[model samples]
Target: MAPKGSTFKSCSCRDETGKKLGRKCQRLNRPDGRWSSTHGRWNYQLELPPHADGTRRSPLRRAGYANQTDAEAELNQAKELLNIAANDQALARQIADLITTAVKTTKQLPSPEEVRRKVRTGQHLNITTTLGEYLPQWLQGRKTLRESSRRSYASNLKLYLIPSLGHIRIDRLRVADVDRMFEEIDELNDLITRARETCDPVLRAQVKGRRRVGAATKQRIRATLRSALKKAIREGLTEVNVASLVELPSGKAPKALVWTPERIAQWRTDLDTHIATMSARRKRLWKDTPSQGHGHNLNRIDAYVGAPRPSKVMVWTPALTKQFLERAELHRWYALYYLIAFRGLRRGEACGLRWTDVDLDVGTVTIRWQIIQIGPEIFEGQPKSDAGEATISLDTSTVTVLRTHRAKQNAERLAAGDTWHDTGLVFTDELGRSIRPNEVTDQFERLAMETGLPPIRLHDLRHGAASFLLAAGHDMKTVQETLRLSSIAIAADTYTSLLPQLARQSAEDAAAIILNAEPAR
Candidate 1:
């Protein structure tokens, strides 16, 4: 029997009341029976050991291992893992080789604060609480970008980015997780475009085959998001900046639709049928009329009577432009097309015209205000730039068109008499006020649907004008000025469809000039 005071070799039995007993302290005997720690110290049980009577025991296991060495090692590993998990960042990296050597679960586990302290050399991080709040801030600092760029970002976010990423926490966002989330954006864009095919009037709906954000714009948004994190870091809000280490997704260019002349023409014509612009223009005209008049007098007999202002110039694409002219009723629409197409005047410039601005003798139109859209109010503003407000020479055809249109307006003035408003706009309704921009766009669309013309839009007249000029052997610098394109690159990019034939024609012209040159006599 093992001694009670010293370490045991074997158990010494003692029955109840301290009476002498034999084999009672067997290795299998527990305090109650023969299978517990109270037995001599051999713990080799498969599960819970059987009683001394030879009955099999039910199965059970301890939380930890039996051997003291094994238990201590496991306890240490658990402590290390807990410590690492405590970090504000998942950047708490572990080295596989040093697993046994490190003092991790020094007897038990470390607290989150203690673990955090040990790993955070200098960094701090917090998870994104919500996605919507961060995106507008990301867009605010983009002041230097072109209006087109800013508009694109605003549009794309509203349409694509926000709906997907809005709910996720910014800090908790991971590259892998974001990648997974966005994997479907491409598919969704495709589905959206396909679904809208029957419904889309312009067919200008975008489908993202590749990433839309440019490398530079992506950098800007990332910088903005990072700046927010930097503020958090500066304020000691976190121990690590997760955004600092994150690698952004590839900034590949998006696949764009081929803007062919035929396609442009088709879309222009198609839009008129689907969108209700014709009715919109008529509504504006009706609102301007006196209750007594049955319809607007195409020929105002009284030249002194005022006219209702024409609506704002609608955006027209190449396909639908013809419908606007046919429906405008006044010969003025014909002249408007010539000015927009040949003279390259903006909607406001054309609308703001007086009989004085046009010189049939000189075939010139002086440009001044091109119209400005300021909130609910319509106001006159100078053209985009000083150069944009200059006069343009027109050809005889345009002059003839204007002459005819002028005659029609004079007749309308004569007929309206006291009922007409005296606004001096050349393209006015029977009552004289400048037309609303929205009404003009709507008119073009309605005309397009009614006439079944190619789906050319009204603003497309400008494109058509620019395209025509480029095709006529004009230089890009001149075209840029004529179109008032913000830059030369823009003129080339946006109007490429118009210039394909012109490009080949130019080469042929150059070839003819070179080969047919006569030697000096």
Candidate 2:
């Protein structure tokens, strides 16, 4: 109910021009006007407090109630809505605005839920802000994300998210809308798969040779959406996070497979046969194929016919790794390769190693910095994790190799004299500049091919190191520490394939410990 001294009045009259003069008749101004039971209507005018600018506000007046009871009911509801004191001008204004909107729209009173949301968020009940507008603002406000992370988030927003979900209002987003976006992505991937399978390799390359977005990419896109929605929720823009309710295709972690003896033999067989067959066919089909002079080269039919698609991460067995090292020993970057293969140093970490971080006398190498490539240019950054920036104990043999490598580098510096760039990197080009990461990968590939070894990616050498340690009976914890992995779980997960054999011995040892207890049989 409203405060004391509130009531409803009625008015009914006609103009001399015979118009139905609603709220405009001169009789409405009378102190004791006669009530018309059949034609007069009830009216209430709420006397509100002054406005925020210290000016009087026009009373919230409404008419057209059929009777005083109806008029009193509306007056009661309005009083309940504006129950705040006069000094709470902000809230008083909100109630005034709410009633004005109700009158204009002629809708029912705002629901309790809607009313609470509006007051809590300090926004109108109806918000028109789009996800597209909020996402950019969210990215700008994220000050702690790394440069690489920010770039990734921006790419997802601009290239994938904004085009799909940007126009939809944040509060209006639905789970079905997000699901439809992913379904479209899946349909496009199907088209990409069909195109790749049907077209010749040369034609596919000419068609830009784009691959379908993978499960991992989709997962990342969802993560970006979830993060943005969380920010919106924090700002009280929306009540629920629809993105959090979405499900995506689970991404599989790439397994690290070692180049065992059987795999090595199989690889050798495939390479020899593939090379001989392709060589013979190329000569015979030279006339049938597209001309090489115009640079519109013909695609190799052999490439499409059962060409090898290498695993993402593959490692060499100890013997093959030793052979590879021996062959690569004659190369200029021998020490770099040795460090990577033996010490499990990442390519970027090895490239980023400075002389100040290496302690040959102490037989320890302190890893601190890494050179990360973004597009063409590379810059120095911290290690992958805090644990990655660690002091790794080196074998005496590795120390000797580093000593010799330092001597060779000094000689090159003396040869260049004033021309040497002096980058202070342990591994560098002849001018003492940091080596490009791609150059290292390409060189490793060429060396592996020349040595007639089974193919494996450069990063696989680090996997091989972990496998070697496990095979030599080192604990997973030790391997984790040596690799500077953040946790033992990661080390174990990465090398789970090598654990069963070691676990069998431990299982037998456990049985032996309890052998004194006789079996029931």
Candidate 3:
């Protein structure tokens, strides 16, 4: 184990002259000698050279024991480490050096657990690796992530994580550091809010330089750090995930607010006042002094004054939805509006719909694919989840809209002749190419503005559909199925705002049931 003839021997010195004989001195060299009381300490010479190729050449030796027993025991421990290391010559060298350093310099042994971990993950027990250095490698190895997901991860890392926590060592990262980053982010949000509130061009230009990072954005940034740290743990870079320990302001799911009669009235009144006042102010300002900066200044002023802060998830009442559908009939993509408003198809799902996925004969459409957007580029990808790919039964009214839309589309195709592209989609541009999702949203906004109705995003149409179903007394589970949400909990949480109305309806139904009972039979 300790090489041939490698055993405990006491340092002997009978001669005090010249080289002084060292361990080869004659007095203490005898095997049977209980003599030489002058030799007080025992020493062992164990040779352990660098076993790995390209490793720096170094002598591995440990000594200075009070007795031969102590010397042999230390030798046995080194032998055991060599046995464990086996074929890993690098590990064997590290273990040898670690043991040697313990005996010679510090007289303290390193933990066996720490030693093995360094060897396994190739971290070499170094505690100075920064998050910035590690996260890039971690993301690079995440080859299985989709394009959109990868872009999101990269964006969070570049825009938030690296800028904030890049220089902090992986092992030295603390929960306090993570918390401070979020606190700063919250402060940045306040700055953005102030910038938007101020109409001063210089103040707005200075403060509105960066996009507002909201609570949702902060949560995503935390998720990115948490995910990266998890990889570090698996690779044995750090024992604890500090990111997991930090807490941030939890982003609440924005409740979808429906436009009631009072809200519609307020919206109309505000719109008329804003337009009339803005027109008069613009005319007076231009007549007084037409400066070069007048146009730019007026645009900025209008953005703050006239722009309405829409709810995160806004919905329209049943009457408003009906009116929207009736007006949308004049639109070329009336079938698209009808399908989303009734069936609750997502914007991407509606855009990705092909004729093959839709069955006009059976009155059903299978949501199999969705057009996902990363920046400006769009690609047809599978649904967000397995539940997202569902076959929804279309109502008779929707089927009729589809038929009429198909007839009109056929007429357009005939007129275009060879110029039309054969995309075979249920909804597309006039040239038959796929419609951009953002274009659809912009069109929806313009149309809603034209109708003088409350503003709602195109995605909110799906929320309206869910609200309609719940209002009709359908179970939450049924709504979950119709929307193709991954779980009933999501459906319950999202539509929980509607529960108060449902409760009143339930109460009325209970009273009617009792009143209509037949003689307590």
Best by lDDT: 2
Q: Best candidate per TM-score, number?
A: 3
User: TM-score of predicted model 2?
Assistant: 0.64
Q: After superposition, how far is residue 383 of candidate 3 from its true place, in Å?
A: 1.0
- Give the lDDT ranking, best first: 2, 3, 1
Clashing pairs in 2: none
Candidate 3 weakest ten by summed lDDT:
295-304
Model 1: lDDT equals: 0.50
TM-score of each model, paired residue for residue: 0.42, 0.64, 0.66
Assess the local accuracy of residue 489 in candidate 1 as a C-alpha lDDT between 0 and 100: 85
User: Tens-digit lDDT track for model 2 on 328-369?
Assistant: 989889999999989999998999999999998889999998
Model 3 ranges off by over 4 Å = 1-51, 54-124, 127-133, 140-151, 162-211, 265-292, 295-311, 414-419, 502-521
Please report the TM-score between candidate 3 and the true structure. 0.66
